[model samples]
Target: MVAIEFPLPRTTVPPKTGPILPDVLRSEWDKLRTVRSTYWTLFAAAATMIGLSAILCGIYVAQYAHLSAKDRALFDPASFSLTGSFLAQLAIGVLGVLVITSEYGSGMIRSTFAAVPQRLTVLAAKAAVFAAVTLVVTTAASLAAFSVGQMILSSKGIGVGLGAPGVLRTVIGTGLYLAVLGLLALSLGTIIRKTAGAIAAVFGLVLVLPTIAGLLPGSLSSVQKFLPSNAGLALVTGSHAGKTVPSLAPWIGFGVFCLYAVAALAVAGVILVRRDA
Candidate 1:
């Protein structure tokens, strides 16, 4: 007798999940928060701003009497305190690059793409989460540094209030600058997919290029204002006193700086979509 084979029961797969930007956002937020580098980098950035500002302001407090007229004229309590922002930018920028590159290095990117499938959405989520975090931390740090610096200056009878001209703008600008700077690094990391190279590219654009540009003729010095770092610094400082070259207005310079980051991210997006993981 021939036995008839029974048909196997069909298993229904729950339909694959639909696109949920918020879910992608939550997943990215979790990834960012779980990483040790996130905390360490944020701490370093804040500490540098607070510690360095205190020292600089303290020195000014001690030397106020002996400071030359030119020195006093060049001094900006807000700008001086936020000077640590320069160093902080380096830390955050490196952290941003690491945020993306670390995944590539550890082969986690494949898993990330496997889960998300939409590569651009993954990058956008990473960017939105990272940008929000950096903005909060850096903005708070900048404000604290400004407050501490101003308090020190107050002891010397030279402190200015938050309501003072450009004071608030400068403080807020520090955070904006850093947030965009980090975005730029993330974009570069996506394009290069290497930590060291991305970091080098960021610093070279922010720090090295300015120095190189300075070597050019004074007439071309105006061109330096377009560089990411210089434009950003101009936006935050809002002053050109004692400078050999003039910078654009605070908002204008910031707009220019943002364009640089936007350009890089736009390119990264195209590459991410068109190229293989």
Candidate 2:
């Protein structure tokens, strides 16, 4: 009898594996970079910051001789250089909102969630990617603005170097503030899930709340310092000798501002998990 040839059993090798967070981060980064809004918003932010800073510094230089003694004495070159941040924050906020909301608007978030399954991880990944990119871009923009503004102010022999007291901190803090502000907007976008509504909410938080807080009477007005915009701005403004309104210490104010973003993200995470996508 002839024996039948025995077949060899196939050996299966398991696919290589690694940490999930890194994969998620890479995916989120890809998504962020591919979007047209990312380029537009970032360009707008950088341009607004550099352009406005240059223009304002130039104006200050031209009018330096006409300024009052008190005004000149009280001027803060570092803070003034970063004034463009005021408008740049809006652009940053819009980009932040779009980072998530665009996916929601197009129903792509469902696919994203389906792939990740762990909704919080996806949110965290998005935040991580956005914060990293925003921090890099804004910090560069802040440095450029500071340099350009200082160059303009130097024409009048009033410019301070990065070595000056608080100058470096102010430059770095402007970027930090804007980065955190963008995170706040991203958190709001996650919560609202509507591009228009989330953007409006971000604008309201950054712009309207401050104005409303300012309008409050007497002791109530003190609450402004606790608001996210004011608190973050305190870090950028550094420490000034005289002010009609006093702000919290730099790091203290930044901590408060961070708390607001943390709280918003916490809420968004909960809602994302507990509710339908």
Candidate 3:
């Protein structure tokens, strides 16, 4: 039998082995930990939240005499002002977007895909890592902001306790909302694959559109109720947002926001699975 001649490959190679899921997760954890921005973002989240809270708490208590009777009776000012998360969420959303966008920006995504082969696994692992880390940190920041803020308020004789009805919901809800919103931004990053665009999308959703919606004529201000960020604000306030916006009960508004986040993440997952890295 004549031997068939074949072109030899240039380099000798051994068969590659794929990583187990646990190993992949550990690798991802290491990657997240090693990033300098991770620490900075966490610090900023805590600082901005606590700092704003302290400042607001001082103002509210010091100016107690200037406030109206209705403001004194219904205000959860401790929770309201301490919920710096309304702005701090920008940091969280940016962190989430960077989870995927950083790799794409730096050309590391190809290596990540090569190591995992199943690209979906990589995205899932990243989400798992991101959500886990964010939930813990955001929860801690929420608690710390609330505690410190209330201490200042109480010193001035104006604050509520967690045991008070609806207070716990506002504190915990802030954490949950931030975590979900971050994941939503992460999904957009996957879909858009560009950092600037992903950030703009988040800002547009949370800020620009809500302001624009309010500026429109009658019932459009009512229409702003459906927007995700504004909807989330309703979860914390027992009266302020409740009186003006078309809010469902607090938990119900949160549920609607959850639906928005999940749908965006699902669409991104499908695209990530089908697309080339």
Candidate 4:
């Protein structure tokens, strides 16, 4: 029987997608924004930055007359307004560490790796998402802190406007410093893969290392300025040279700080690819 043979339906396989970076980024953003810790940490950072700035500015206004002439002369309203960044860094750093380490702690990382397969893409997405959020939030907090602090300072006739030399740079650099600091913490978290260990490592680099550097012999003490926190702070504080350990130029110091984060992130990517989740 010569039955008309109809061609069998061809099942065409869909073309494989090359890069999933956008999808991965969206996933990472969703994960980050949905977590309770994310909101709490971000709130803590913003609160500390703006609240402490206001408090410090108020104190200075009250104590303005008691200060020595040199103290008054050395008073940098811009730098003083950002004093909260010291504490804010810890909160932001913890958030950064948690961003990756929490997944590892909960064994979600395995699922994440299974889903993405491209480990480097996962890592890059996490860094990019976290960095972007951190920059926006911290920058807004910094601007608020600067504005509030300067308003308080103005009551004492000591406020510097945004147009003042280095005021705008310091305000913006504070955010950049915090964002990069968060990236550094994320890299540490990726490398360590443990929440506590990664946090300790982050704080060690940011806080302890500078202290240790300070204890070096006088000739070696200059090394403090090159450390990550100190280097980043130079930009935020807008200090090139002063009674403190001489700082690198603002941009130079920030560049050195960024290199440290980049180097750590590179190591993290290598280890992430080589190690099992």
Candidate 5:
């Protein structure tokens, strides 16, 4: 007897999925917001930016008459308001490094990569989310600080208008500078993959490098203008008759500073893909 033969079961392949950048961005954003460090770091940055600016402006107001002519001549009310950025940078930079390094430290990076196999995409999402958040928060804080400082200085008739030459640029450029600084730190974190080491490297580059460069001979000291912090600061403290004397144009210096961050990110993208998570 011939047994009835059943037809072979038909095989089917799963439908292919297209790239979903929004999903990646959403995931990165969720990861960033879920962590407590994000709130604490951002709070610290905001408080420092506003608090230090107010306090510093108060000191300047009180000491206006006592300051030597040379010191008085170089005082910039706009830059004074943004002075908090120096301290805020540490907070922003450290948090930026922690954003990625913490994942590596906790072995969560592997899971992230498993969920999103395109490593550079993951990096880009992180950078984009962090940069956007930083830009908003820092810009608001910068504007507030500037307004408050200007109001305080107005008490002494030394306040400048937002419309004043270089004033608006300094105020807005400060926020942009901080955003780029955060991106640079994030790139370094991606490359180093360790929290402490990455923080140290970033801080060293930002803080120590300028100090070291300052010690060079007068002829070579011009090199300091090209340093990342110096160049970035140029955007926020452009040349004023009696204040900061920027060697490069504000936009030019900012462009140079951007190059450093871009170069670091490009290198990080290459290393991230070539190595295991």
Candidate 6:
């Protein structure tokens, strides 16, 4: 038998099918919308932020009705005692915590991981969707607060509008601040996985730490202004030149909030990719 050597056909190398970020983003967005818990939380955030903001504004406006022109000029009473936001932030934080923890609670995280096996992709997707939603809702609430608050204040002969120098900026900036803070909470929850822990952590970061510093002796007050809540709040103000005020400028204050978000998300991203869901 003559054994003829057949020519070997060339083998083809498979093309690299890397993960698509945009597709993952679309999938995540769909997940967010269909998820009932997410909707509820978002609704809660919007309602609390807008509703309580208006109420608080009304309360303070009524109290400040006796203010002289100079007192009004020197004060941003309209922004103060958003005192409601202190409580409203708790709602926003809870929503942020649930956004991730609920998935783990329902064991849906396994399905999410199976579909989008690239773990970091899932984390990134969640962050983007949650952050975007927060920004929109917060901006709306802030604007509503400004409008309704202004109307109530106007009823008390306190007229402040978007054109009132820093009024518009403050209105918008406070919204951005809350939204960023929400993302930070979400990032914290993603890493911790325990609702209580994340909630406590966020509260400590947002409220407790600032309070602690403010209560410190005069020696510490100067340095405490650099904390997330204190420094970050300046973004909503036109100036911070008052005595004993933060050395942090408005933009810099907002930057501190960004740093908190970035650091928390980075840690959570690392854990999500390296650890099992």
lDDT of 6 by residue, 75-140 (tens): 564465243555666777887887788888789889988877888878888888877887887778
**Regions of candidate 2 where Cα sits further than 4 Å from its true position:** 1-16
Task: Answer with 1 or 5, whichever has the higher TM-score.
Answer: 1
**Which parts of model 3 have CA positions greater than 4 angstroms off?**
1-19, 238-243
Tens digit per residue, CA lDDT, model 4, 1-277: 8676569656697766877999899999999999999999999999999999999999999999899988888889988988999999999999999999999999999999889999999999999999999999999999999999999999989998989888889999999999999999999999998999999998998889988898898778888889999998888876522347767788999999999999999999999999988
TM-score order of candidates, best first?
2, 4, 1, 5, 3, 6
Question: What is the full ranking by lDDT, best candidate first?
Answer: 4, 2, 5, 1, 3, 6
In order, what lDDT does every prediction score?
0.89, 0.91, 0.81, 0.92, 0.90, 0.75
Q: Point out the higher-scoring one by TM-score: 3 or 5.
A: 5
lDDT of 5: 0.90
- lDDT of candidate 1? 0.89
The model with the greatest lDDT is: 4
lDDT, residue 230, candidate 5: 88
Across 62-163, the per-residue lDDT of candidate 2 in tens digits comes to 989999999999999988988899999999999999988998999999999888898899999999999999999999999999999999999998898999
**Colliding residue pairs in candidate 6:** none
Candidate 5, 269: how far from true, in Å?
Answer: 0.4
Q: Candidate 4: global Cα-lDDT?
A: 0.92
Off by over 4 Å in 5: 1-16, 68-73, 242-246
Q: Which candidate is the best by TM-score?
A: 2
Model 3, range 1-277, lDDT digits (tens) per residue? 9676677445666664676677778878988999988888777877888888888787878888898888777777546655688778889888888988999999899888887887767777888888888888987888888988888888757677888778888888778888888888889999999999999998888889888888878765677777888777667664453255466668778888888888888899899988888
